[model samples]
Target chain A: MKRIRTAVQIIFTIFTNGYAYGFLRGKIYQGNLKYACVPGLNCYSCPGAVGSCPLGALQALLNRRGFQVPFAMLGFFFLFGSLFGRFICGWLCPFGLVQDLLHKIPLSRKRKRLPFHHILKYGKYVVLICLVGAGSLFLFGGFAKVPAFCKYLCPSGTLFGALPLLASNEALRDQAGGLFSWKLGILIVLLILSVKVYRPFCQYLCPLGAIYGWFNRFSLVQVHWEKERCISCGACQRACPVDLAPEEISRSAECIRCGKCAAACPEGCLHFSKKPGPNPDTKPDLKPEKRT
Target chain B: MNVMNQWNQKGGSRQHGSRGWLFGLLVGAAFLCIGGIRGELAVIWQKAVMICMECIGIG
Candidate 1:
């Protein structure tokens, strides 16, 4: 499943950003299909990118008056989030693909699990609320300039959108300044961290991930834990790359729905379900039976 | 940890029945219709095609 997912990610990445020769000429695709959202964190400025990024669109629109709502972009997000949730992160995002590939690099430590990882999961939400949501709307919107998140943070933008342009355009390289260096530093740090920590950007900084994760409870495709079938074997927990125990598999907001846990389950107790289930609650015992 | 262990040990109904699917479809349709009316496609096109100097922090 993981191998297939990775293949799909690569294919989607190429299909969306396939103007490979454009990089040499330093030209971004200026076609009509560019209006469509690719449902992932692909950069619009990528030479081969045929679709716009939802985050970038949202930010871009913020700086323009009478475009406050960003209805089309929000609609795309609403549809995709409702259908797949963070499955896009696991299965389609180019940057997510990059992180997974980076983490696969042979290292002294096979996997480095961060302590208080659950607490860190909220970081992405904070970014969504403050940087992407507020900063773009309030600060940059008033200034009628570039969005704050894209300018200051967004390693994916730096890596896919900027780095390629810089490599190809000599004038762009000569014009590189302090902000470029700062973004490069961020990109370097994220790239190195991706090797040690599984999807550090998705877990800690991606506003897109945070937005999609909220819909996980309602997404049509979801992980359903069959308590009756589970034998309490530790295989699923052991197999989880992000270190989520079997019980935590369905509910963990940070779960990318990568299917590692489902694959590891010996009894096939874990599976995807289209039926509506109680969104997994972090506090299982205290969760009120809201349905009943 | 103990609560998680206990919760995992217990058996219960796995999935629920909700109107989320219906609601989701309605919301998606509404957004798409409004987006079409608003000329959001043109906005998306302009943004996507333009070289965002700010995206690279060049500004």
Candidate 2:
């Protein structure tokens, strides 16, 4: 079963993200595979997306001034996050899988976990506010628009989004300047980090993951625990990829609901449920008067 | 540790024991193969979304 599921995952990642589409980009704009995520973080600007990426849409909305907020993209992010939490980060996000693949290099450790994580986890929100704020300032035509996040940050956009654009249009590459250079530097830093760490972006820097985490507590989709049966062996906590103590906050809003905890559970106590919990406080009716 | 031991013992309804994953994989593979075969972009996206949903811990 695990092998089959893994194979399915491999095949889907191959086709959906346009690992195939990159081979076909720019030859024709209307290729059949253009709809896929187009593996390796291809840019939305390459022009094959039937539906725009949430980040691209967010950038577009922020760069236009009619709305005080980028509400449409915000709503989409919330809806996706609410439905799956960081599950998208785990299973579907094309870039996330990239980070995961990079983090698996063999490295001996005197200590397995990092000693310092004091403030890095908040990087994504910083990415969110700083870039959005800067872009908003330039949108009024008093200044020309530059996608600040795409320019100064966002390794995915640099590696996946910009390369394809550069390859396809000589004009765009010729027009590029320090902004493109800046994104390349960010991508380089991210590449070095990915080699050493286990998904630093998702851990401390993915605004998408942060947004989704807000909804994990209330989403219909959930990790349900039978607390009554919990023995506290600590397997679930260790199995968690995000380093969350799964037993303490088994269904925590921050949890992406990844099954590593369940898979690690020698006990069958952890499972997904449409309803949120095996609520410990609730009691079943045992009233004698009901017999009357 | 004791609570976990109890959990290990507290079996409830019988699980199908991983058949669900098998079924999901077959369905997902079918979507991928079919999408590849027919060149239906919309169908490819829809199937991709569905596969991602199940592969997601939730379902």
Candidate 3:
């Protein structure tokens, strides 16, 4: 299952960023497909990206000269959130793939949870509300629009868009200034942290993750937990990459549905289901089966 | 009677959940069409094609 997910991630990454010429020439794809938004944190400015970043599009629309609402981008978010929730993060996002790969590197101590993990989880919501929402809408100077999150904090843009563009284009390299340095520093720190911590960005900082998380409870696909089959063992929680106890918080907003918990369950209590209800065969009074 | 009531309640909730999902899809589609009619897709295209220096954190 993990291998299948990795293959899907790699395939989707390539499919979304398949413009070979763009990478060679240090130019973004200027085709009509750029108008369509991908359901992940890909940067539109990426040399090989064929679709727009939904967060970037939202900010751009909000920062437009007039006070026009970004109805289409909101709709895009709504549709994707309702359908997949953070399953996109687990299986589609290129940066998530990057972090997943980075976390596999040999480390003395790989921490499952970061410092202040509980308090820090709310930071992404703050970013969603402030940087992506209000900062783009209200903090722009007259006649100039600002994509606050993309401009100030997005490491994905720095890694996939800026670094590649600068690598090929000497003019863009020369144009790099303090802002570029700052964003690059952020990228480096996040990448380094990824080696030790599991998906620091997704757990704490991604506005896109925060958006998708809101739909976890009602999304079309979900990690369903059969309460009757749970044996009170903590194996699922221990195996969870993001430290969520799937048996207790079956519909938790923070669950990315990576199936780590499901994979770890010895009793087959946790499973993915399309329908939002208890198992038809559930026997509430059934005894917990002992696992060999 | 109690078991029947519980089963009926579960069935109703499941039906409600499906309805909510369909309603969400409909709402999303409606807003998408409205935005397209208002030329939002073109606006997105214009922004995306242009090299957003700020987005790259270069400026």
lDDT of 3 by residue, A1-292 (tens): 7888899999999999999898999999999998899999999999999999998889888988778888998788778888887899999999999999999999748998788998999999999999999889878645686889998999999999998999998989999999999999999999999999999999999999999987765678778877766786778889988887553334466888888888888888788887554523333443546778
Could you give the interface RMSD of each candidate, to one decimal? Answer: 3.7, 13.9, 3.6
> Which prediction has the highest TM-score against the true structure?
3
Q: Which portions of model 2 show Cα errors greater than 4 Å?
A: A1-12, A19-22, A25-42, A46-50, A108-114, A137-142, A167-171, A248-253, A277-292, B1-59
Clashes of each: 2, 12, 0
Worst 10 residues of 1 chain B by lDDT: B8-17
**lDDT string, candidate 2, A35-93, tens digits:** 44332223444333333345544554455534345444444444455455555656666
TM-score per candidate, chains pooled: 0.88, 0.67, 0.91
Single out the weakest 10-residue window by summed lDDT for candidate 1 chain A: A283-292
Instruction: Tell me what TM-score chain A of model 1 achieves.
Output: 0.91
TM-score of 3: 0.91
Model 3 chain A poorest 10 in a row by lDDT: A277-286
Candidate 1: residue A48 Cα off by (Å): 1.0
**Tens-place lDDT digits, model 1, residues B1-59:** 57743553452223322445456656877887788788877777888898877677686
* Candidate 3 whole-model C-alpha lDDT, 0 to 1: 0.84
Ranking by DockQ: 3, 1, 2
Stretches of model 3 off by over 4 angstroms after superposition: A277-292, B1-16
